[model samples]
Target chain A: MRNIRIAVSYDGTTYHGFQTQPIGNTVQDVLEHAIRMLTGEQTSVTASGRTDAGVHARRQVINFETSSPIPVNRWALALNSWLPGDIVVLQADEVAPSFHASYNARRKTYRYGIDTSKFGDVFERNYRLHYPMPLRLQEMKAALAHVVGKHDFTSFASRRSTKTSHVRTILDARMEESEGKLDIFLTGDGFLYNMVRIIVGTLFWVGEGKLSADDFKRILEARNRTAAGPTAVAHGLMLWDVEYDD
Target chain B: MRNIRIAVSYDGTTYHGFQTQPIGNTVQDVLEHAIRMLTGEQTSVTASGRTDAGVHARRQVINFETSSPIPVNRWALALNSWLPGDIVVLQADEVAPSFHASYNARRKTYRYGIDTSKFGDVFERNYRLHYPMPLRLQEMKAALAHVVGKHDFTSFASRRSTKTSHVRTILDARMEESEGKLDIFLTGDGFLYNMVRIIVGTLFWVGEGKLSADDFKRILEARNRTAAGPTAVAHGLMLWDVEYDD
Candidate 1:
């Protein structure tokens, strides 16, 4: 058996999520079915992480063991031909059997895009959040500073989570604003369910002057989901990139 | 009766174009129906020009005569509630009673967007053309010079046009390129059907070294539709804006 790794990008507006479900309209379901048809093997594919419904991904890594005779480099083109237009395998490679898409040591970067352009950009209507309200960039930055570091992220986690521990390390966090568009980028060792969206929602509150930077720190220390703002819209969030040791 | 002018924008990928048809799916058909539903009166809506199927518009001028008691300022908000998300009315104003959407226009600006970004952009999937070939920018600029002044543009027109005269003035023509993207902006007194798209297609051939600058000049003077390159795809073309001498 050979372990094959593939990098994929997808527009997730019409998809249920990255994980397989009973409904079978998710990105994972579509990709697995295409792989099954092409390689004639019914196998489970593991992803770097799962994204919610309506979320996008610029590059999501996945791995699976297959016994097919096809060359690893040609798997991308072959599978893309069978997959839908929204999901595309950007590249494929043969990796060591020890490499796991989810458990391997690495960091991930996510971005939440907000369209401040008045009347909004029509081309990005499905991929971004149209926020017409005024935002204080400086305040948002201050709030972001309090989020960088290793800490218990229970305040940023989803209420439905059943994790054994909520501790995680936030490597970097910053906001990029230009041309009436704001993009919040966060790099971390890992994220809890809905953590990035909840962080962005809290930053928006800071920009609106409703939540101060000092208050954000207190909320983080509280280690409770109810202590933070609402989770940002799912469509605004994107799994931008994943990094692994060479 | 009062003449109300509206500036509208739309993602026209799914519509049958800007003009009303017996098919009842055109932009005009949808707009007129929404007006009737909001103002309780059936009215004929006039547009500055017609757009082909799958073409978009950032700003299209439209006017209509109505007897409703609603103020013009409120029409945009009221009509937006009734229209689909793809179409939006940007602004509304009262024009002179003699004003016409199709006849009383001054100048119009159209743009053709090319996704020089390899593999195209996910968000702009429906708004741009994916042209991955290398382009000679200097040669394209030189070719655009031959198409700048007043000329009989019969070579760039489509066969479905009913206008008697093919003579038109090209007020301005230029190409804007940035960050693996190219945009061709053309401002003209008026245009024949499919004029901008054909001109773009012809310029692309010049960039590819298939046609020289001098050959483009002769094509312009030939006064024949077969003298030029094929019409570019409708998805890349957009009616950017319209200016009127008020």
Candidate 2:
């Protein structure tokens, strides 16, 4: 069997999520259905990770083994033709059998959006969290700086995380604002389940004056899930990019 | 009875347009239902203008007579409590009995968005027209300049327009692009049926080298609906704002 890797993009607004549900609408179910219609093969696709409901993805990498004779390069256009308008196959690539979509990933970046505009933004109402409260950008930046570097992210992970180890290397983190639109970016070698959302929640608390940089560091050292802030809603989070060693 | 005016915002993605439909879901149907639930009144709302299907609105001025004793300032918050998340009341005011939502309007501004990036923007797929083709900005600007000021807008109007007079005054028109997102802005005293869509379509033809700036001016003077390019789709057109004499 040949291993085929594909990069997919989707608007997760009305979707159940990237993972397959028992009978709900999901990105995976739609993609697999499209592939079956075109190639007459029922295959399971392995994705980089499971994105929660309402969490969008700019490019989510997935891989599957298929015996279809169609060229790998043409898979993108063919699959996109059968897929729904909300989900699109951005690109496709042939890879070695050893190239895993999740375990072999090197880095990933996530973005969280906060709309701080006093006036409601009608067009972006579904994409970002509308937080009209005043925020201190400098304080958020200072707190974000402390989140970078290698550490145990136990406090930032969800209670349902089945991974044995919580240690991860956060390569970079930053915050920027454009006309009351705040963007928080986080890049890391790997992330625990709900790590990005929890981090954003903690940063929001810091910006709201409910926590400090020192308190965030202490929570990280505590290595307890209860020490961290609440998780941000899924609608405001996006899987921006995922890097895999070529 | 008091004449209550309110500015409303809505995401028109799933709506059948601003007008009330016989069966399908519409912005007017939803807003009227919400108003009925809040005030127990079945008054008809008068809007500044009707937006086509899939067209959004940032601030659509609307008014209706109501016997509710709630303060006008608090109606915005109360009405929004019952409305769906996609539609929101931006502001509310008690207008004079003579104040009319449609007839008292002096100016209206519309914004059309174009996604010029090579790659598909997943988030903006529904809100913008994905036109990856190369466009000449200078040519589009020059064509837009000829469209400004007073003109017989018969060529720029839809064939289905039923207005007695086709002459209208375009106050301003401009084009701006940032980060591969192009925005065409137009302001006018009023517009004919589908005038903004046709204007954008004509400008698009000019940018693509299909029509010159001089040809655009000639087309305007032709006073014929068939003299201009096809009308653009309604998804990219947004009623940005409406001005009143008050």
Candidate 3:
């Protein structure tokens, strides 16, 4: 058996999520279906993590074992012919037999986009969160600065998480603004369910003057999900990148 | 009755086109329906021009006569509440009684986007044309430069056009490239049916070295539709702006 790793990008507007489910079509379902048609093997593909419905991905990593004789580099070209326009295989490579896409991931980066323009752009309605109200940019930046470093992120995680430990090490957190749009970037070793979306939601409150930067820190220390703001919509979030040890 | 002029923008992926058709829903149909719901008037709207199916608009000028007493500035917000998210009224104003959207227009601008990346972007699939091949940028620019000034555009127009004269003045034509993507901008006093798309199609031939710059100029002088290249797809084109004499 050979372990094959692939990077993909998708416009998740029509998909249920990244994982295979019994009820609805998903990114994994389409990928595996394409693989089955190309290789004639019933194989399972593992991804770094799952993204929610309407969420997008710039680069998502996946790994699968195959016994086919096709060259590794040709897999992307072959699979893309069977895949739809909304999902594309960016690159494919042969890795060690023991490589695991999920467990071997070292760090992941996510980006959230918010458009504050009056009457949001028509072409970007599916890709950005439209928040027309004025925002306190400096306050939002100050609040995000406190999000870096190691912490128990229970307050930012969704209640659906069943993990025993909510502890995760955040490597970096920052925001960039241009032309009435704000992009928040977060890099971390691991993330819980809905962690990024909840963090962005709480920052919206800080930007709206309902909570101060110090209050944000206190909420993180509280370690209660109710202490955070509402979860932001999923369409604005994108899986930016994934890293692994070489 | 007062003449209300509105500038609107639409994604155009879901609608049939800008003009109302007998079989399918269109941007004009939606706007007229929204007007009926808001003001109880079955009003007719006139646009600067008709866009083909799947063509987008960044700023389309439209005018309608309304007997309802809604203020001019509030029309955007009121109409937006009744319209879908894909279409938005950017601004509204009270214009002169004799001002017409189609007849009084002075100039119009359009933009076409092409992606030459190895693998096209998923998020921009609906907005740009994906042509994964090397292009001769200098040749395409030279070919486009000859398109400026008044000329008989019979070769670039579609066979369906019934106009008596095919003469039009192209004010400016240029292109800009960034990160494997090219944006072509064209401004003119007017365009015939499918004129801009046919021009882009001919330029594509020049980019691929199938035709030379001087050959493109000769095709324009031929004044025969069979001498020109194919008509490009409509989804990559956008109505950028419309200007009228103040």
Candidate 4:
């Protein structure tokens, strides 16, 4: 059997999330079913990470083993034909047998989009967070600088996470605004559950003048979830890119 | 009664179209309802144009008359608070008593988005047209030249149109491709019914090698509905902007 790596993209609005659940539809369930129909092999596929419902992914990595004789490029077309319109396999290729989708990931980048206009956009409701108030960009930028390096991000992690390590390395964090839209981009070695959302919410507080930059720093040192702001909505977050090293 | 002009935006996925329809919800119905809720006034609103079902608008011009003493900026906030999340009043101001949303327009711009990747985007399913094959940009550009002049666009209009004059002047027509996405932008004095969609369809056919640039020009001269390509899906089109001369 050959191990195949597939790069996928999905609009997660219709999905329960990236991982399969017993109650609702998932990106994984539909993808696995499509693979089964194409190759007639009941193979379990693993992704680089799990995204919550209403979140989107531009380039999500997944890997599975199959014995089918189909060419690598055909995997994308074959699987996509059976999959629904909301999920699609962007590219597929053969990989080393030792490669693992989850274990081999080097870094992940996520983008949180906010529409700061007084009025929201009708078409982008599913993809962006609408915040009517004018955000203080300079204050938000100062607060972001405090979270750019490695730290124990317990303040930003969700309480439901089972991971023992609360520390992670944050490579970069920045905010960009254009045409009345504000986007916060974060790149890290790995993220804890709801880490991105919580960080965004905390930054929003800074933008709103409710929390100062020093307060953000204090929250980081607290190492407690209660110190951070509320988790932002799921729809505003997107897994923009996942990096893997050879 | 004071004449009020408002800039509106709507996600057209759930509505039958922009105009009021007996069959399904519309942008007008929602906007009128929101206005009635805000001022307790029976108001009649007129739009610059009636957009078809599943077609979005970024800045649609609308007008109404009311005696309410509310401030201009408050109109947006009040109407938005009562309107559904899919529709929003971006701005509101008092216009001259004789100002008409439909008759006083100087120009309008429409944008059509196409995702040409082999895999479709699930998140943009309601906002873009997904074509799996690679498109020829040069051919599409060549065809666009034929559409950038004054002409009777009966060939590009639907037979169901009620407008008496099919002649319209196209100021600009261009195609842009970025990040595997293709966008067609058209600016004109006005458009015939389904004119923009049919033009896009014909350009798509030209890009796909099914038609030539000369063929597109021939169709424009035919002045018959059968000469043009099929009307592209409404979901892929957006009323991007409307311009008025003071």
Highest DockQ model number: 3
The CA lDDT at A72 in model 1 is 82
Q: Over 4 Å off in model 3, which ranges?
A: none
Candidate 2 lDDT over residue span A89-206, tens digit each: 8899999998889988899999998888755576777778889899767887987888799899999999999999999999999887898699999999998999999998888888
lDDT for residue B45 in candidate 4, whole number 0-100: 94
Best by lDDT: 3
Over A1-246, each residue of candidate 1 has an lDDT whose tens digit, in order, gives: 999999999999999999999987999999999999999999899999999999999999999999998998789879988988788787899999999998984999999999997567666778889896899889889889888999999999998988899999999999899997899999999999999999988888888989998888999999988889989999999999998884
Where model 1 places Cα greater than 4 Å from the true spot, the runs are A69-73
For residue A184, give model 2's deviation from the true position in Å. Answer: 1.5
lDDT of 3 by residue, A1-246 (tens): 989999999999999999988876999999999999999999899999999999999999999999999998799989999999999999999999889989999999999999888888887888889999998889999999888999999999999999999999999999999996889999999999999999999999999999999999999999999999999999999999999996
Could you arrange the candidates by lDDT from highest to lowest? Answer: 3, 4, 1, 2
Error of 4 at A200 (Å): 1.6
Once fitted onto the true fold, the runs of candidate 4 whose alpha carbons sit more than 4 angstroms away are none
Off by over 4 Å in 2: none
* Per-model TM-score versus the true fold: 0.94, 0.93, 0.98, 0.94
Query: For candidate 2, what is the DockQ-based docking class?
Result: acceptable
Candidate 4 chain A weakest ten by summed lDDT: A116-125
lDDT string for model 4 (B1-246, tens) is 989999998888889999888885888988888988988998889999999999999889999999999988789888888988888888889999999999999999999999876667767777899886877789889989888889999999999989999999999999888886889999999999899999999888898899999999999999999988889999999999999998
Indicate the residue-level lDDT of B136 in model 1. Answer: 89
Docking class of 1: acceptable
DockQ (Cα-based) for each candidate: 0.42, 0.47, 0.79, 0.76
